[model samples]
Target: MLRTVAVPLLDPTASFELGVLCEVFGIDRTEQGVPAFDYRVCGEHPGRPVRTTSGYAVVADHGFDVLADADLIALPASTNHADHPPQLLEALRAAFDRGAWVMSVCSGAFVLGAAGLLDGRRCTTHWRLTDELAAAYPQAVVEPDVLYVEDGRVLTSAGTAAGIDAALHLVRRELGSGVAATIARRMVVPPQRDGGQRQYVETPVPRCDADTLQPVLAWAVERLHEDLGVERLAREAVLSQRTFARRFRAETGTTPHSWVTGQRVLLARRLLEDTDLSVDEVARRSGLGTAAMLRHHFAAVVGTTPVGYRRTFRQTA
Candidate 1:
């Protein structure tokens, strides 16, 4: 029963992002078997035309009063990244004080940070503005590489499309994966993107011409129960360890060991959600060897214990 209220700040980009949220949360999807949200679009002033960066004006039907009763408040990306109006900041602070889940899309993190909601919280913004955000708000734990960061109630997305991912994540968290999947299928977008994935680049995808490592990755994924090492994969790729390490990082934006660990963690999550395996069995099957080791890596990467994750996501069969 999440009630969503979007604060459409003055600017084209922010308005468009607000429109995106509306398309996702405001639409009545009961025909598709998806639960509908109590959604509202609020502006600083009621019945006023707000200017957008997209060279148009949008008239809002409500004002900040809608936010006071909202269970969730979304701050869409703003054109002016450096400044937030005093009244808007005060309104957001009041909303947060009332225990509402607050979220931001792309540069919208700037607005949240300005309102002091993101202080000491792990958050992310568009990768292009990561440096500026970090320099401006040193207290925020800024994760530049993540597509989005869900730090309890305060969620922030990396960029435009990543906002959709973040919104779907909220849907999954609140309404369940089945509902989220239905929404995604209707929108023709992936049900989920690993939050840790790098943002999509406009540059052409690099062709893996010299890559003898395709088989190695496939083999590693299939045999995740076994201990894996760079040297072992290097042999499979027909390259020395050093050469393999360099190539792996270049292609994946991560070290080989890190990539293997991530894959194992992902496998463990799937098992936890889809099976009733004991922690020890899941750890063994995912190549972490022991329950204690699973807890350590799971806590580090997934930010939760295996048992805890299962309790949250396990589907009853």
Candidate 2:
């Protein structure tokens, strides 16, 4: 249902975020059985060099006209968000009004807010700027904790790697998780990940050491089907429950329960996609206990029940 993609270049673009869009949507992966987007990079002036905030410049082959035929329009972080080129904003508004999928990475959400597209939509940006986005666009519900938010065809993601998550999510939604997973594998990232900006904001990932909790995390990952409650995990880590909790908050940025639930949801998605497992079987395999419990968690975490999810992805193949 989606194919064409256009990324519009604004002045002083953040190179990494712009690069993220290009890597996700611009690359040709049809040889690998993935749908290749008709991708275009556009600027206000065709062939004019746009300077990046990182001290380099790049050029766009097309002008704003390229956006007209696009199924998706991606915005990257720009040097300026409060005031945008009128023509660019108008084009963005037209794309949104016509029901095209429009997404922004990092500070690029500011451009959507300025265009009035974010008004009354559930959106997000980098955690550091969520308050600014909310203050600037009072009509928008700015959720600061999540990696991304989808309200209709408009999507906004947080900083850096979070853009990958948001883009892969869209790909999975439109083209199925198989295609998304393929792209993710090629990119060497996960198709879907749990937790969010909350953990990162509270505590960044610490430098690894012998006493680091990564070994414990790896151990827990392999045993998601087992009882990994705090008590057991803490004892396995050879620390008091209180100390383990504190260190976990420091290292991973989320509680043990929230982290494990996310892992289970991911496993359920994998089972739904790659196995012909029934709801009860998937529930048991994913360690969620029952079909009813799996449905509740899967729907809450994945926005679809297990059966519906399986139906969507399985039918795609």
Candidate 3:
């Protein structure tokens, strides 16, 4: 359903966030069996150079007119968010009113707020600026901790890599996990990261030899169908239970149990899309143990029953 995407350029663009949108939607992946979106990079004036924060300028081939036909309109971060052209704000409102998906990355949420789109809607921006966003738009319910939030057709993401997480989530929701996974594989990013995950980890990832859990975590993912309790993982990592627990939280920003549960849920999602396995079989293979348990956790994490999720995605797959 998301066939066309339009991104309007503003002055002093954050190139990394803009690049995220281009990488996710602009690339031609039809050879890989993923749908190719009609991706448009637009400026208020066609062929005008737009300044980027990285000390470079890029030109847009299209103008704001292209947005009228867009299935989605994504906003990248800019140095200036409080003030946008009246026409740009009106165009955003018109696109939203016509039921097109609208998304913002980091400080770009302020543009959406300025457009009156965030009013009475739950949204989020980067954690560093969450209070600013909330204060500027008092009616908007701003969730500071999460990577992203989806309310109706609008999506907002936190800083940097979180944009990839949020964009892949939208792809998975609209095109099925298989398509999202293909795109992620080509991009060399994890296929899924729960939007509810903390935006700020004590350490974004393990950076030292002693602190790195890469090997143990990789080992755990392959053996997710087995019991991945802290005791067992600690034994594999050669650390005592208490030390392992402390380090796991420091490295991954979540408990071992929570991380394992998330992996299992991801496995269950893949099975639902790629196989004809019954709910009970999927539960067993995903290490969920039982159908009732799968339904409970699947709904809690995925916002839908296993059966419903399969029915919706399998059609596209």
Candidate 4:
């Protein structure tokens, strides 16, 4: 249903953010069975070159007229977060009034705030600019920690690469996980990343003897069906439980328990998407121990129940 995607550009745009939108929505992947979106780059004035933060200028082939019928309108980051064009703001308001999806990357949330779309909605931008965004739009519920937040038809993401996560989430929500996976496979990125993950780590890394935990982590992932408590993992890593805890936090930016739980949830997602296994079986195989436990953790991490997730994302022959 998300067919047409229009991007409205402002001057001094962040090229990487703009490229993220283009990569996710504009690329043609029909050969891989991913439906191509009707992507357009538009501006207030058609055919006029807009300067980018990287000292390059790009021109929009269309104007705001393209946004009138767009299923999705994405705004990319720009250095000039304040003072969006009045016409662009009006177009955004009209699009939202008609129930079209509106998304912003990084500081582009400023444009949405100016159009009154972010008021009273949970949203997020880059962590560095979260305070400024909250102060500027007091009525908006700003979540400074999330990678992205989706409220109603509006979606806002944290800086840079988080745009890919938000965009892929929308694709999966609308088109199905199969289609999203196809696109992600072609892009060589993970098919799905939970939007609730923290955008940045504020705590300093603890000192550890090891440089990385890749081998131990990889070993744990393969044995997710087995008990993966901190004590067991610490034994495998040949370290004291206290040292393993500190080193795990330093190496992975999360506790051993949290990381293992996240991996199990990911395994559960794969099983739900690629198999017709019963929810109880998925729980058992993913080391969740019981259906109730799976449901509880699945809901907490995925925002959906196992049955609901399978119904939504299950691949069919």
List all candidate RMSDs to the true structure: 9.4, 9.9, 10.7, 9.6
Model 1, stretches more than 4 Å misplaced? 195-317
Tens-place lDDT digits, model 3, residues 98-144? 99999998888999999999999999988788889999999999987
Query: Over the stretch 22-118, how does candidate 1's per-residue lDDT look in tens digits?
Result: 7678888999998768777777777888777777778878877777778788878877886566777877788778777788988999988998988
Model 4, span 1-317: residue lDDT tens: 89999999899789999999999999988888888899999988889999999999999999999999999999999989788989899889999999999999999999999999999999999988889999999999998778889999999999988899899989999999999898888888888764343313332322335656777888888899999999999999899999989989877788888788888888888898898889899999999999999998987777667887676578885
| Candidate 3: C-alpha lDDT | 0.87
Answer with 3 or 4, whichever has the higher TM-score.
4
Model 4 off-target regions past 4 Å? Answer: 194-199, 202-317
The global Cα lDDT (0 to 1) of model 1 is 0.79
How displaced is residue 263 in candidate 4, in Å?
25
The per-prediction tally of clashing pairs is: 4, 0, 0, 0
True lDDT of residue 215, candidate 2: 88
Provide the overall lDDT of each model, using Cα atoms, as 2-decimal numbers: 0.79, 0.86, 0.87, 0.87
lDDT of 2 by residue, 1-317 (tens): 78999999989899999989989898999999999899899999989999999999999999999888788999998758687888888888899889899999999999999889999899999999999889989999999878899999999999988999999999999999999999999999878876666545533223335457888987887888889999999998999999999988777777989888888888887788888878899889888999999988876666556776676566333
Candidate 2 or 3, higher TM-score?
Answer: 2
At residue 243, candidate 1 shows an lDDT of: 94
Would you give me the overall lDDT of model 4?
A: 0.87
Query: Cα deviation of 132 in candidate 4 (Å)?
Result: 0.7
